[model samples]
Target: MATPGVFLISAFVFAFAAANIGGALSYTRPPPRQTLSVPLADDLDSNSPQQVHVSLVGEDKMRISWITEDRAPAIVEYGTSPGVYGSSAMGNTSSYKFITYKSGKIHDVVIGPLNPNTVYYYRCSLDSSRAFSFKTPPAQLPIKFAITADLGQSGWTNSTLQHIAASNYDVLLLPGDLSYADLLQPQWDSFGRLLEPLASQRPWMVTQGNHEIEKIPVIHPHAFTSYNARWHMPFEESVSDSNLYYSFDVASVHVVMLGSYTDFDPQSAQYAWLQADLGKVNRSRTPWLVVLIHAPWYNSNTAHQGEAESDNMRKLHGRVDL
Candidate 1:
């Protein structure tokens, strides 16, 4: 069941819990990275497509995003059946140049008017890539979601993904700290490959966390350049001008993904958006309202002790129970 609350511990806590549950078996070796098999021609070597994933843009709509080593045309052929692409959508492509490196080209395509609860087949090509399939969210109530936070490309990640796959989640919500790339650009590539199994098949909605603040002193001092370029959330539909905070709907639930690392003060833009968003939520349509943030305003964790903004939020919204 999905509960409305704060996540004090990060993704690593889940990994450690799994280890404890397995007893001595927990000492077993971590699983190897999963890979998809494709023909040599489809691989396209350096220019091959990678890190392909999907995000829910709105009702009957989805966003497919991917990364490529070189600039190329981005197109997605998708339909309800394998090898029978009946529809196609063309979207924008961009690349980020930071410090001494220029990141790979990123592509995002939004496809829409899809039938709810149906499986869709897709093949993305920047150069050449394999086909993948995904099932849309159900039209009615009872949507299952899998959520994890602060994910880095570590050995424990393999096991965590196995558990998520077994759960049969309709969507995945990562609140923050994806890849933990810090400043190592290659780590982002590796992390994307690691998450393909779950992310490629379902919408992976995320919010920025502190770890994503890859600020290079005296060089590339801007924040969220990589995160913004890759994960294109549908903030525009919700009237939010920032990717750091946005909301989406699935089934009867309205999910609000917030950025704890960004400004959340009473006078900040995010706070204003938060108030307006919550005020407009039609409980008659979406009965459940769930909030996700990387850092809790009231967490007992010593590392974040004496946090202040959560108090402001509590005062702003008043005491209420889910």
Candidate 2:
């Protein structure tokens, strides 16, 4: 006969083992979906703007970003009504080279001390036929944000975009894993063209993910070389030295986007900036504080378990309320 304490210990061990076996048996993953590549418009002229998207600049400004195959002026003309030009803004253009791939001229123009909640028609370069319009976010509360993540170019991505478009959300928050180009540079252009339809009309704020880090050991040693050149976030406006992380405000909400792929150690610039950014936030003005990070601090999924980024970031939870 076993002692009472020994019997209890034996029973506890049995139960724990049974639970682990049960969990493992129940876990199942669905089949992978087919990948789809969205092609560029066949009718677009060489100088015509393609992959046009917009992002919020400061409080009253919007940054219009697009790509052109040939040399095109980085100019944007805009007004409240369609086909009417009341204001114009000039901006800069740049391109990047990845391995043997050379990108088209990328243009970014910041427009307006725009009115909140009002629609503004805009044309890129000198083309009136390619006119696009976007509504600025409201000045007050009750704002809706359509949050999404891991938006690789696929058939599923198309469905997701359609669902988001019908939702009528004010802004879109993407925590990372965009494009999934993974060093195939042309895929980035394809992804941009796919996103232009929705991203053009609304502000899409995003952070960097592991997929964005297309670093090769000898040939291409740099990380985020492609991503930094393409998705230009308002990092400078927030006084952030790197484009990997930044903060922005929409209505009564304050959003901070953190980079999981970047250095997040306590001694790193990202960690230091996060402390200062959170400290500067006025809780009275922006009632809600939302932080976006690529890797989750706590996750039940088996794929990305026990990551250093997640562990290190979780440690800061006690130091900061976030």
Q: Weakest 10 consecutive residues, lDDT, candidate 2?
A: 6-15
- Residue 315 shift from truth in candidate 2, angstroms: 33
Candidate that would win on lDDT: 2
TM-score of each: 0.81, 0.85
Clashing pairs in 1: none
lDDT (C-alpha) at residue 317 in model 2: 52
lDDT of 2 by residue, 208-258 (tens): 888999999999999998889889999999999999999998887788898
Error of 1 at 169 (Å): 0.7
User: Which tens-of-lDDT digit does each residue in 1-322 have in candidate 1?
Assistant: 3344322333323111221222232122335554322222443566677788999998789999888787766888889977888899999999887677788889899997888888999888733347788999897677888988866776667677889999988889898989877887767777777777678898899988888899877788899888898888989988897999999888878889888878889999999999999999977787778888887665355653323333333443443452
Clashing pairs in 2: none
lDDT of the candidates, in the order given: 0.77, 0.83
